[model samples]
Target: MSKILDAFLNENLEALRDQGLYNEIDAVEGANGPIIQVNGKKLINLSSNNYLGLATNEELKQVAKKAIDEYGVGAGAVRTINGTMDLHVKLEEKLAEFKGTEAAISYQSGFNCNMAAISAVMDKNDAILSDQLNHASIIDGCRLSKAKIIAYKHSDMDDLRTKAKEAKESGLYNKIMVITDGVFSMDGDIAKLPEIVEIAKEFDLITYVDDAHGSGVTGKGKGTVKHFGLEKEIDFQIGTLSKAIGVVGGYVAGKKNLIDWLKVRSRPFLFSTAVTPGDVAAITRAVEMIMESTELHDRLWENGDYLKAGLKKLGFEIGASETPITPCIIGDEKLTQQFSKRLVEEGVYAKAIVFPTVPKGTGRVRNMPTAAHTKEMLDDALAIYEKVGRELGVIN
Candidate 1:
C-alpha cells in the first residue's frame, strides 16, 4: 500500500474515532426478523425496515429456491447483453402492473436505480428542485445527472413552488423536475403528495417520488403514489424491493417511453449484472402475496400504532411520524449513541442516528415496527425501553 494513502486513511479514521462518529458493525448471528440475534444475544428488534415481514415468509423462500434450482444463481451479465432472463422480464411486468404504470424497469439496487434513472432523463442544462431531506440516493442521482439542483425545505410545497418558478423563470435550463421521498424515513412522516402534485402542475415540473419505504407499508401495500391516488400524475414512481418486498433490487415505474429509454441508456443497467434469481423470485412472490391478502399490511399498521402510542405515553418525544417508522428524539449525539448501546444491552436492538445521517443536534433513535412483531413482542420491547429510559434518565 502507498504510505501517503495509509496516512490519509489513518488521519480521517482517527478524527472519526475522536468525535465518536465511527459506528461498529455488529454481526447478527441468525435470521433478521421481528427479533434478531446479535453477538449471541436475542434482542427485540426495532431497527429493521422489514415492514411486512415478507423477508422470512416460507412461500417466498420456496419461490426463490425453485428459481435457483432452475436458473442457477446470478444473471451472469449486464441487462443489455445476455443477462436479461425471462424472469427479469416477468418481474418488470409484475412491477409495472403492481404500480399501475405503463411500464417499469428494474436495477441492481434502489440506490443504483436513483443513480441510473435520474441521469438517464435529466442533463446539466436541466434543473432539479429536490427536497432538502430526500434520501441520499436521490441526491447522488441528481448530482450524477449534472442537473442544477436546488433544494427546497422538507415537504414544503410553497418552497417547492417558489424554487420551481425561479428555476423556470430564470431561463437557466430546458426542464425542471421536483424529486422527493414518498415518506421521509428519518421522521416517519408521509409526504404531502397532493400539495406536491399541485405545485408540479402549476410549474410544469416533472414529479418524482422515491417511495423506498412507502411500498409494502402504505396504500394497502401498493405504494405512496397509489396511496395518494396520483398514479398518473407522478413522472417517476421509484421504490425498493429489499425492504417490505422481502428481497433486493429497485425499480422505476413510469411511462413506457421512459422505461425504454432507461433500458437503453442507464449506466448501471447496462453495466451491472441483473439481480440474482433467488431475489427476483422472492420479490415477485412478495408482490403476489401482498396482492392476495392484507393480513401483513394490517398487522404492520396495528404494530406501528401500538408502538407509537406506547412511545408517546412513555414521555418520549416521538417525532411527527405518520407511518410505522418512529423516532425517539434524543438530542445529544453521544448520549443518543450511549442510549442505543444500553437498549441493546437491555435486549432491545433499535439503533441510533446522529449528525450527518440527521442534522446535528437532532440525533434520534429510530424504530421500525413490522408485521412480524406481535403485541407480546412489542410489549416486551416497550418494557425494555422503559427500563432503559429510566436507567439513562431520559424518562421518569
Candidate 2:
C-alpha cells in the first residue's frame, strides 16, 4: 500500500471516530432470524430487515439446496452471454405477476437494480422529481442517470405537485419521472402513491416506486402500489427479493417495452453475472408462497402492532410508522448509540440510526419486528427496552 493512501485512510477514519460516527460491524454467528447470536450472546434481534421471516424458511432452504444440487453454485457469466437460465426467466415472470406488471427484470441486488434501471431509461435531458426521503439506492441511481434531479419535500403531495408542474412546464427536458420509496425505511411511513399517481397523470410524468420494504408485508403481500390499488398506474415498480422475499436479488417490474429496453441497455445486466440458480429458485418459491397465502403477512402486522403498542405504552417516543419498522426516537446521537449498546447488553439487538442516515439530531434506535418474532420474544424485547429507556432517562 502507498504511504500517501495509508495517510489519507488514517485521517478520515480518525475523523469518523472523533465524531462517533464510525460503525462497528458485528457478525451474526448463525442464521439471521427473529433472534440472532452476536459476540457469543443470543439476543432478540430487532435490526434485521427480514420482514416476513422467510429467510430461514425450511421450504425455501430445501428448494435452494435442491437447485444447487441440480444446477451448481454460480451463474458462470453475465445475462447477455449464456447465463440467462430457465430459473431466471421463471423468477422474472413471477415478479411481473406479483407486481401486476406486464414484465420484470431481475438484478443481483436491489441497489444494483436501481443503479441499472434508472440510468438505463433516464438521461441528462430529463428531469427527475425525487422524494427527499427516498432510499440511498434511489438517490445514487438518479445521480447516475445524469438527469436533472429535483428533490421534492418528503411525502408532501403539494410539494410534489408543484415540482411536477414546474418540471413539465420548464420544457428543458425530454421526460420527467417521479421516483419515491413505497415505504420510507427509517420512519416506516408508506408513500402517498394515490396522490403521486394523480400528479403523474396530470403531469404525464413516469412514476417509479421502490417498494423494497413494502413487498411481502403489505397489500396481502402484493406491495404498496397494490395496497393502494394503483398497480397499473406506476411505470416502474422496483422490489427486492432479499428483504421480505427471504432471498437475494432485486427486480424492476413494468411494461414489456421498458423491460425489453432494460434487458439490452442496463449496464449491470449486460456486464455483471446473473443471480445464482439457488437464489432464483428460492426467490421464485418465496414469491409463490406470498401470493398464495396471507398467513405470514397477517402475523407480521400483528407483531409490529404488538411491539409498537408496547414501546408506546412504555412512554418511549416511537415515531410515525405505518409499517412493522419501529424507531425509538432519542435525539442525542451519543445517547442514542449508548441506548442501543445497552439493549444489546441486555439481550436485545436494535441498531442506532444517527446523523447522515436520518437528520443530525434525530438519532433513533430502529426496530424491525418480523413475523418470525414470537409474542414472548417481543415481550422480552419490550422489557429490555423499558429498562434501557429508564436507565437512559428516555422513559418515565
Cα lDDT listed for each candidate: 0.91, 0.94
- TM-scores of all predicted structures: 0.98, 0.98
lDDT of 1 at 296: 93
As a TM-score, model 2 comes out at 0.98
Q: Write the per-residue lDDT of candidate 1 for residues 260-301, one digit (tens) a residue.
A: 999999999999999998888888878888888889999999
Instruction: Report how far off residue 214 is in candidate 1 (Å).
Output: 0.3
Candidate 1, residue 162: the lDDT equals: 81
Q: By TM-score, how accurate is candidate 1? A: 0.98
Give the alpha carbon lDDT tens digit for every residue of 349-376 in model 2: 9999987899888989999999999999
Best lDDT among the predictions, by candidate number: 2
